[model samples]
Target chain A: MEDPLGKLMPSEVEFIAEDAPITITPNFQAGVFLFLKERVGPFKPQRPMEVPMWLAVSLRRRDKCVIHVPEWLSVDALTTKLEEEKMQQKQFVHMPAHFQEISSILFDVASQDVPNSEECRQLIQAIVDVRTAKIRQGGLDDMKDSLAIQLNNVTQMEITSIRQFACHAMDAFNRLSSV
Target chain B: MSYFDIDDILMQEERLPCVASIDVIKMGSLDPSSATPYLRKGSKVDLPLWLIKSYREKNGEDIFEVDPPKFLGPKYLDMLRADATVINLQSWCSHFFSFAITYLTLFQDGDLATTIQDSFGHRYLVILDISQNAVQDDTSEKTRNLDQLERQLFHAGLQDDRAQQQWRRRQAHRILPWAGAPRRDAFELGHLTKRPKLSFS
Candidate 1:
């Protein structure tokens, strides 16, 4: 099998026993956790950058975008807490998006107060525009991996903006990405 | 002397050496969907020495092949070493909690636990739950599967003596059962309820 990294084929085959397939429940709102099932195949041939497909949709619903972290439970009680949590709707305890999407959101939020903020906004919108095109070119089925990649790219772009926008959103972006 | 009681173990150098061994250590997300394949067949994995050393500054060796060892890997053993350094029990407790968070899992149902454990003793619990869908409320298979994963973590917390003691202590004072006696305490209370009849014996 070809190495997933694809840069330099590793000398050793290093065959890790393939793990069983993973199944997930989809969250319709987040524009991120739309995939109901996730399999760990070799990284896709050409990955998408980290711009979220649902950025437009999430932005439209930003007013409703709320961060609700569940209360911390006892050490031993975590499993129980998570199980109880699993029983309920998957709440967006962290910022209301995946790691990459959260970074982009923070980036946009920071730029909202910058010089030529409208221009910055357009730059971000352009990135989102490119992402939306990619999504449309490859239907939802083929877009999952690409979406993850684009989301990562958007996150990287946000990281670079930390110097430009020293805001809570930037602070959060740093923390979330580091985590 | 704070929240966790490691004084006795720390006092005994040989019994609880400066570095005791760890038999099993599993790490990663606790969500069943995220924890599935790793926990599949309840598989337990070894922690590399470099990673274990990242947690503690001490000379150590991989003892996975050694008989009569303390643990399956060094991470759990390092957790034991860290317990001795903390003065506060809450800190110690939290340390253990983090260990559980990163290493162990919670499996929910008794039957599923039995089924999975029966198939793979300690190795089956490593499955990862990567579910991207929203977790639901119904007692459907999805919920049951996820619950089983939680139950595995709960039990994993009980695998070690430190974790076991904390688990028991916490359960002794759990927040539930508003209007009734807890079963564990009830059993102990039942024995006390027979007071005054002890004179004959």
Candidate 2:
């Protein structure tokens, strides 16, 4: 509600995305604690348990847990994804809908937990750059004269990035087309 | 155009070259130099769009044959057709696209509308590129030629780009609260209880 522009802030999108589940190995032993609705833990030493990203980040920040990087976030996987993204001229590779947010959070909070963190970061950056360039170069030209443009497998951040331009341009096109 | 749209009102104030096809009575003063009380047949005058609209004939034929502004003429259109990205749309008309659309709608010229759409497409790409990359850089010269609508579109893209940059630097939020929220630190001593009154005495 505080956002007057009626567009979600990047940080706000990150906040919503932090609810996606991630696996973490907590160092401390603890029984299940009632977190809002569902019970959350039974944290035992070195036992990887799936929990919300928020919980994992909290535990990692306090030196109580090691976040297990998701399979897609690994260097090998992201490299292949980056190559796949480049190979597809007009199609967006299907990524975790919350890939940008989740990756940013992981890199910020638990880079040490993941092996080859630097390479993984670089690979993710490459994937994002290639994808963004594809969207700009290929997706936008198809937008002319049409009321709606199809963009399958697009992520939330990618959509957010172009939301203002897309909406305004479509409105402008519709106005001209009404003649 | 909507009643409260300031841009439409401003555009309507811009004059159009028009010629009276038939004799017009008691409207001679519309031309500043005319001494006669009645406008003579086949008289030429520059009239605002609003006045031209109000002077419509009962048979639905335009009382004044309006000559489109020079910007919509073949020369300017040819220039646009060549490369729309280089044209200074603001100098030609601050509301260039809007005026073109309105003119096309009124005249029912299908081809002119297509020309406008084509130019818009070309200009949109340039605008998108400029706005997305101008991050924290001075782009005064780059954006100087943009028309009002295009300028708004540029600003929209610029804001999103700047937001992403700020977010990456970790300067976008004061405190990264646990996982979900950038906590605002809502609680304060004053919010819990009333403050002591300041006495004048």
Task: Identify the leading candidate in terms of TM-score.
Answer: 2
Model 2: CA > 4 A from native: A1-5, A29-39, A42-45, B54-59, B173-201
Backbone Cα, N, C clashes tallied per candidate: 71, 0
CA lDDT of every candidate: 0.27, 0.79
lDDT comparing candidate 1 with the true structure: 0.27
lDDT of 2 by residue, B125-179 (tens): 8988889889558878878889877877788788778877777765655434456
What TM-score does each prediction get for chain A alone?
Answer: 0.21, 0.92
Per residue, candidate 1 scores C-alpha lDDT tens digits across B1-96 of 233434312211111112224332353332234343232333333433323433443435532231211431354344434442222223223222
Report the lDDT of model 1 for residue B170: 29
Candidate 2 global CA lDDT score:
0.79
State what share of the real interface contacts each candidate retains.
0.00, 0.48
